[model samples]
Target chain A: MTGVTARRRGRPPRAESGDTRDRILTAAREEFSERGYEKTSVRGIAKAAGVDSALVHHYFGTKEQVFEAAVEVAFAPALDAPDAVADGPLDEVGERLARFVLGVWENPTTRKPLLAIVRSAVNNETAAAVFRGLVVSQLLRRVAARLDLPDAELRVELAAAQLVGCAMLRYVIRVEPLASADLEAIIARVAPVVQGHLTGP
Target chain B: MTGVTARRRGRPPRAESGDTRDRILTAAREEFSERGYEKTSVRGIAKAAGVDSALVHHYFGTKEQVFEAAVEVAFAPALDAPDAVADGPLDEVGERLARFVLGVWENPTTRKPLLAIVRSAVNNETAAAVFRGLVVSQLLRRVAARLDLPDAELRVELAAAQLVGCAMLRYVIRVEPLASADLEAIIARVAPVVQGHLTGP
Candidate 1:
């Protein structure tokens, strides 16, 4: 333990590595948010994080990988739906899933990164590909496995589509009524629809 | 008629001006698609249309107006929802609406421009604002006026969100199963849920 602490001020294989990695990831997200994906560079991220450029590469590899990391974090809370499903009644899974997914967008912190990633994904084919591979599909697979139905993945995606679409209109596109509506009121209206998609015949 | 025929070449007077405007709009759309919103310019659209830059500005006023024209065209198909609602049985209004919106994406010509405008909206705030003010809200207001419910606009937007979200996955994000599923099959499954949002208890 002493040697681990003594060997480096900012090297790998110690508790500091975790802190350093998180610092770099946070910087990467902020850079992506402020400068966007096409303009934000590894060097810019390194500068923002106050670390050497080599260190960012050492931690997260390429710009694409770094963006993927941001998507991972952006999608983390919504990705927890399956675990929540594990504990709830099957019929009410829709409410739980809807509440969980919307809850991510409800919070200002997680929503900011999601906004950045969706914008990046929208404008860039490579970013879109990374987003396609990383977030929703990853969440869908876990969800489909838990759902245990014949057309499990399709059903889950339809449900996911409902939630994702609502968020886009409310948060991203900022359509009225839905945009300014009460969160629980939306949940009340939307949960049954989500439940229907997930469990209805 | 004789004076109209005698007008100078490429100078707008009557029939030619409509053709020229359409040409400029087509050129603007292609520029927005290939280069994106922030990068695409009035001069670029003029150049693509083989017209003078002054002509583009004279017709559309600014780059923002040009993008709005593109959004207007892209959303034209989905914008017909209110008309369909007027004719159809209210119980099946959801199916008609879903089929209308999704049908736009199903066509290659319409889908291409929708993709372009959405990508533009995602990357540029001006484009998003234009989109918000011009397209979906405009569609919702017309739709809400027809629905004749207590929370008509909110109900319309929720239904719109489902269709929009489903399109984003199937057409934009290209998620599997739902992405590859049959159109009618999707219509069958999604219509009921959309109907519930529209007119369900």
Candidate 2:
């Protein structure tokens, strides 16, 4: 404890490593948002963060790693999706998912980075690959595992496709009616479809 | 009939405007695919077509118009979607839509330009707006109108979201399981959810 307080102000202590990591992630998110995956470089992100490129390599080893970290942060809320299935009644899991996924897009803070990830994933093969890995392995598969039903994985993916498509149109593409429609009304219509995927015969 | 016989092959008749238009659209799709919307210029497209830029201007007034024309060509198959709703039994409309939308992505000839449009729409705001307009006005709204039900538009949009989301994952993002799954299996799994959206109580 004494060593923590005794450190000099000029140099950042090891404890500040978390802050440095976060600053780098913020800068990376901004760069990826502006230029996308192919055009963004580690040096560029480091320069934006006022850090050495080597330091960036030290924390996040590669551009893919950096992008993955950025995605994790962007999708932090969505990572909680499995809990929606875990916590709710099986029949209502679809409604919980529709509400939770849409809620992420409706919130402005999450939407910015999400738009970047969605845009980058659409345009770049590598970004899409990484995005797919996270969505399938980390998010959707975990949700599917809870269903204990035949074709459970397919059902979850279909549900995911539905939710992802809705987000693409309503938030990123800004398709009207759906884009400006009431949130609950959308949930009311979409939840049953999702529920059918989760529990239907 | 005399006018049809009067046309000669040299320099393409003035009546051959349709062929010239198709060539320009093909070139535009290629350029937009390679460089995306912002970086793609009329001169670039015209050069690719082995024609003068003025000819491109004569055919399509602006870059936006050229892009719109390109979208129309790419979405030609989907333009028939209204008929899918119209020709099918009301109960089977969902299966018809799921099969038709997925079939567009499955066909190599159509997928190339559709991929370009999806990639462009995701990355560029102007492109997304144009894409949203065409999808909502030309495709989804027309399909929605045929349903004799309250909130038909919203129901159709919800179904579109699900199907579009599936295509985004399967073709655009190339997410697995969904991407590689058998076509009939997917149709079987997805149609019910779509049917529910269209005919749910």
Please list all clashing residue pairs in model 2, or write none if there are none: none
Model 1, residue pairs in steric clash = none
Using TM-score as the measure, the top candidate is 2
> What are the TM-scores, per candidate, against the unseen true structure?
0.88, 0.90
Error of 2 at A13 (Å): 1.0
Per-residue lDDT over B13-102 for candidate 2, one digit per residue giving the tens place of the 0 to 100 score: 664778788888999999998778877999999999888999999988899889988988888767877666557688898888888778
RMSD of each: 3.8, 3.2
- DockQ in order: 0.66, 0.79
| Residue-level lDDT tens digits of model 1 in B146-191 | 6799998888889988998899889887888888999999999999
TM-score of chain A, model number 1: 0.85
lDDT of 1 by residue, A1-201 (tens): 878678765565767788888888999999887666887899999998899999999988999999888778766666666577535688888888888778889999888888787778767768778877876666667767777999988888899889989998899878787889999999999999888887789
Task: Please report the candidate that would top DockQ against the real structure.
Answer: 2
Q: C-alpha displacement of A195 in model 2, angstroms?
A: 1.7
Interface RMSD of each: 1.3, 1.1
